[model samples]
Target chain A: MPHLPPLLAKPVDIAPLWLVERVARMIFSCVLKAHPDLFARLGDYRESRYCFSPSDLQLHFRVVPATQALSVSRGTPPPADAHIEGPIALLLGLLEGRCDADALFFSRDLSVSGDMEAMLALRNTLDDSAIDLPRVIGSFGGPFSPVVTGFARYIRTRVLEGRETAWN
Target chain B: MELICPAGTPAAFREALEAGADAVYCGFRDETNARNFPGLNFSREELRQSIALARRKNVQTFVALNTFMRAGDEALWYSAADDAVALGADALILADFGLMAYVAERYPQQRLHVSVQASASNPDAIRFLVETFNAKRVVLPRVLTVQDIARLTSQIDCEVEIFVFGGLCVMAEGRCSLSSYATGKSPNMNGVCSPASHVRYREEGGSLVSELGAYTINRFGSGEASGYPTLCKGRFDVAGAEGYTFEDPVSLDVIDEIDALRAAGVSALKIEGRQRGRAYVAEVVSVLKKALGATSAERAPLVSRLRTLSEGQRTTSGAYDKRWR
Candidate 1:
């Protein structure tokens, strides 16, 4: 197996799964609150916003760090401002800056629902931010390399286990 | 009374027909069909030719258009239905409700057989399909026992086709997302499960590790035989347990149970594995055709002869006996 980068090594149990997801959401909300220009391209003056949907076992965060966000589920789709719905691997690929939003959208991995401009704003915002998972691990005094590596390992393990997504 | 066999390709179709299959079931080469492998299934022209050939042999051809339709891409499925009807298919096997509705509404003259992908386990669901869409036959999922099959036959108006031999899916059909979760492609969405596109085999430290996508599904030493990587049958570790957690690698061989199945009112005996070669089709078909005629006492010896050809050299009655559950 190849080595996983430090960014993906964070352990799931560092906090509750819900808290970990909520923390990621809070980070995005704070980033949007601090820098409105970051999201300007993603939204218009009338439709500047962020959308988040947390299922019982999965958390989805689509933010317009600059303008608009859209969300969709299996049967229901939210208004398309910034759209993203995917298994954890694809979602992680988008959030970790490892994948381009355009590739995911074109490949039909992550679907878009609302205004393309607003969706782009949210995608760009999420793509540009450096979430600094290692720093978060260090503050908690956990093994940074091992955690990120473990998370990546878990992804690889569960993928083999035939679990598909990172949700229940 | 009909022996419907699966044909992954034209060669398999020929093999099944020559082996005395009364009817052969196959799919198109595209995503409209379920066995969406590279060299498997018939093209439109090939299907047209195969239908004519089967007709000469007095064997019917059923086209499997079993995949679920995506939100924006109902056109592909719609066109497939039109093509199947135009090409003179004996029947159209379908699972999707919207697509079933489309076929029912668009080509009412064409016969409809319900694919096991719908997971319609109950009599009510079967009756609904029969009453609403006029399904002529239904391939029941492997989750039901012989008693269940008998009960279902007593209740439903349509004919039932039971899988008698070939690969056994331990998981309930259409309900599993293990393949889609590992690889982005899915049987429900893309008409394939554990597709070869994402499979990788590597020799490491004198042992072979088989991977699906990026995850290792199986590892075997030089002495061990490697099996195909199906999620439900794959060995895994969960809660400090390691081994075949769901099901051991095996095939479903009910060669000896043909009499029981006949007694239970099974209209057709199906052999799975459209991905298999023509030789496999011929061998399995010949054995099954003979077994279909043999008495219960005579079948034991024939079933024993078929043991070596079975996957992993082991077979299960597989939900036919409720104790296996």
Candidate 2:
């Protein structure tokens, strides 16, 4: 997965932090509703605090599975049990289990710190759950499901375009 | 030769079978098998369902009860063997001598394949397993050259299985204690080598320092590809020169040596990584399946793609040719 253009982040960069944080919370709620057992496979690490910091964006999201809460901030987030930093596209690809985390890490495209086991457990759990972001986002749109799904898919395609998920 | 693939999950098993695996090997989610990582492996019900699907597709299913049993805990491994057999596994891939003996006496008709953990390289070792437990096949350790394999095949009575792709551990398989010395966990006992729980990566002086417990395994400069600190593949300062002293961080891929392996009388080719995702399983299975059926020249590009999938985007023929000393 490639990094997004600065132009794509222009509008979001200008948007107020509260508005962005609210939107992130709403999306997180939608994801949780779609995959109730998402953190079930995490087992002992279910309580670990996970931080996702997208290098291309100003936003950082933190999640503590024990609380089932997603909080977003403009600057550095609080201390986490595990934290992963990468391009927003790569982060999304990993969320959808479309990108190979090991491959991405091996190639130095992503950087992770803190508990490796907790992060690996999360990765495996996510991969097995088969999270479809477009579908999940669309499911919340009611009558506008198809249009929402199409737009999400189109954006995802553009982000992942020419990047074969195969290898290298 | 049969194409045997590994499946840690049902989704991986389905992908392997769908990608044209002749046999798919999996393990129960416990200490009974190797690659016993969190959020991985199959439950009893999952194994039962997977075996049924493989049988319907006419593909063999091998259950890996490959870990050694601990004292007073033999019952756990023993029960796993019974459950795997009861689920109609085409073969039980086992490494424990006591468990193998138990299976031999109780389920005489069930087929047994010596796991790589057994490290049965010599004719005598192979003969011992085959003679005592009637093991139909033996998965050779990753320390044999093609010539060594050919010679062993010429002398042994049972079929030979060799690792053709995936994670490479260059130690004397199942006998190494480096992981335990660092993490107090070894694959033979706990089904993990350099267990992730003890692994940590830290930024130090513009380099990424990967450590296994208190021991620093390797340091990677900016933008350099890196792999897990599996001790065997870690870099260390030896004779005042720092480099990969044991083995480099690379995966084992012998796609180019298919003809040589075949001529060496390998009865089955195995792709490792039971802990990998289904996409990895699917890609490796499909490409290798094509290579097995294609001419040598047609295998070139496929081999190239496989290297990209290898750990750290680097690969080796490993001990297959004995080129590295």
Candidate 3:
């Protein structure tokens, strides 16, 4: 058979990249809104301390590029208040509610470092964001892509049903 | 025949020792140990004093340096292992093969017990530890049935330690990535699972929703008991129906099965709450020590009493019966 043009050689797999960046932006927006002071100074640093605007809030977070995260930190650092490590997919997993933070912690899939104060701040901030499910899906452009929208709906429904793990 | 208990802090360690525990296990206040909770576990000085105190009572002390070693950062784990040995730890409960290799090579004289984080579920996995690292004991994961334990004990060369009480982890030990996937702190990495730091309780539609990180794991009505917001026991919605698909909120009460476990060749029975207060530890341990001699039928009432002390006032035999799933 004659070769098709490179553009049409294969249907683009924009799902992974699109999915990750979209969710990253959501997490970004939530964190920015949660701590505007920290976001204003985020700059391009590889590591940061995200001290909340008020309360006794403080956390040290390290942002490793997706590829380098595995090699940079093997496990959560007790000194780090929060961590954004792992491939972009893993972070996306959290934002999309496809992952459980408790399981991740047990499996060392997402490592954290630091004291409980930092831990408490990060947890409280993330809880307040509620960026998963309908909110995440609604934020995306275009009429809800059936595939993405379906996944979001499924997650929400399952979460409501008390079956947290996707595998189950 | 030792009763190994966890101690999240120096006070907890002293508490465990005073509570008739034959031995207490603790970790440094870092990733080196599995119970890496804040305001918990021991500092180096505290560990030293704790060990000395336990030694005075002829009680053994073990240090858990259980988490995996990051590439190029094996030194920290190694140093922790070495320090544990230096501080006169009776045994070092280890998980990582690389760390085990280091300890075997450097501190060959020091005893090594495999941490439950290794999740050696079968004879082959247990054999690997025995042959490779010469581990003296293996803390079996909580997923095994009593029959499974019998089969495993018949094949493995090492002593077997199993969880008898306290928090129930439904997932396969050391394998599930649920917690870190949510809030970025994990048991394997940070030594905590479904950590309290990440838990939030909010009132919604006249119900109390318990959230861990960004996910609502459970919701309770006025008459219902609210369980600790651990990810595994958290009730969630699946396929548009709500129920606990993972595990019910309950404490493991193997008190009734102690005789069966003993007959199956279990070498040790572990109580899970190192973060618990001295009063709770003393009460539970004292009761269990007494139950160790009682018949299984007689132990049933104690199990009921333990349920009253559980987070949601529920109790389970865990994987012992094999029908819970």
Candidate 4:
């Protein structure tokens, strides 16, 4: 392996897994609210457990979607129906269509395992339902919403700049 | 000129055909093709069906057996070519010299195309493939200017295809080893570069960092758009200057250069996203189809729309414009 810069050798925590899950649940809930048919389009796999593992963060989330409700918990479920694992930046890019899902998967930057149909459905649904994380988080006008949005923006900027600078 | 598009799956194949693609190119679900992503590509049955569908619509189906063959795994690539031919592929796009020779000898009647993965940029290299393998067309690598293409077209005997849109590889095709150096997988042999299995992202000091293998490709700031962590597109510090040292994380959009390409005696316009989804295939093909027939005045808005679909919201003509060199 090539030498990584000394500044990037150590992992830093901008937010904990629990905080990320909590914010993810809130953001997904808002996404569901805006696009009511989003989860419905998931068909029979609406209740399936999906695992998202951010390799660098050493964190994983088991996401479950019930009718009109979405839950994200830290760590994997006992038996996940599908797993989408990648860098958090690429995962977020998948949501916003900023990153090419195929490019990530082709370059081996993203991996999907288990339920192929469910994964495809999830991918198509995400592609169809436009998701803007900052906009959604910022829309939650409450005492803590600004803090959430600020943190989200901070993370977004760092990841994006990292991605942009890494190559171009 | 023909509009050749990429289709990673059956649905995307159908989408491209429906969206006015003159031909659709794809690969089998394995490492035989360059865009070897998991959960993508077509199975044998799917390819058969897709070809039938394309035939029904009067659109050609080209099978990409473009990945280089390992010495011991020669049969695998030969089998891929046999299967592609048996499945009624209109043409076989190939890269390996041995595989090309094998296909040329085995299926003498099958139409053969030189893949961009061959990196036959100059007239001499391209002429060698055309004369040796009887390749009918050659997909030019994204390293030549429109003028360079025009010059090569005048010198080469076979048809020339150039990438018009989608992801851009900064390095020369078939020669880049950055991904293999960072990750064990080789795009030539394994049909993947910067494989997803080797990528990781971490947050350090409020900055988000993307790593491919053990190398830190880039670090991002707050609210910035993140691009994919391909080795070629990553930002790096060269002599203390922090920026993309090789190339930017930008997509190649040559919609505005259609006339230049057409004038250059180009045979076809190729879209580069086979690993993309059906919606992307439909959207991009639909726009390019319109652009093909629209006037310059009518194309400005369409070009802007394409920019929205580019990587990191950025697009370039790449080496198509001489200024980039």
The C-alpha TM-scores of every prediction are: 0.65, 0.95, 0.66, 0.72
Candidate 2 displacement at residue B93 in angstroms: 1.3
Q: How well is candidate 3 docked (DockQ)?
A: 0.02
Give me candidate 3's TM-score against the actual structure. 0.66
lDDT of 2 by residue, A82-157 (tens): 9999889888887876776777788877889999889888877876777788888787789999999999999988
Off by over 4 Å in 1: A1-168
Model 2 per-residue lDDT tens digits across residues B1-325? 9999999878788888999999999998888888888888888998899999998899999999999999999999989999999999999999989999999999999999999998888999999999999999999999999999999999989999999999998887889899999999999999988888998988888688999999999999987888878888889989999999788899998888999999999999999988877767877898899899999999988778766667888998888878634
By DockQ rank, best first, the candidates go 2, 4, 3, 1
Cα distance off (Å), candidate 3, residue B278: 2.8
Model 3, B249-299: lDDT tens digits are 777887777778889999999988765433345556767766776777777
lDDT of 4 by residue, B1-325 (tens): 8999988767678778888999999998789999876556777988999999899999999999989998888888888899999999999999999999999999999999999999999989999998999999999999999999999999999999999999898678988898999998878888988776676765567565778888999876654546667888889888998898778878999888898889999999999888676656777888888899998788879767656556766788888895733
Model 1 over residues B1-325: C-alpha lDDT tens digits?
Answer: 6788888756568778898999999998778876776545677987998999999999999999999988898999999899999999999999998999998998888999999888888999999999899898999999888888988898888899988888787666777898999999888888888886676655578565667887888776654545566777777888888888777767888777777788889999988877655545666788778888888888778767444445555678888876833
In model 3, how large is the Cα lDDT of residue B134?
87
Highest TM-score against the true fold, candidate? 2
Evaluation by lDDT, superior candidate among 2 and 3: 2
- lDDT tens digits, residues A1-168, model 4? 012233542433445556666776787778777777665446567777787776655456676766444444444444677788777777876776455455454344566666655676577556545567876877885777788788878867666653321111
Pick the lDDT winner. 2
Cα error, residue A155 of model 2, in Å, equals 3.1
A-chain TM-score, model 4: 0.70
lDDT of 3 at B193: 79
**Judged by DockQ cut-offs, is candidate 2 incorrect, acceptable, medium or high?**
acceptable
Which candidate model has the greater lDDT, 2 or 4?
2
- Of 2 and 3, the candidate ahead on DockQ is 2
Q: Each model's DockQ?
A: 0.01, 0.49, 0.02, 0.06
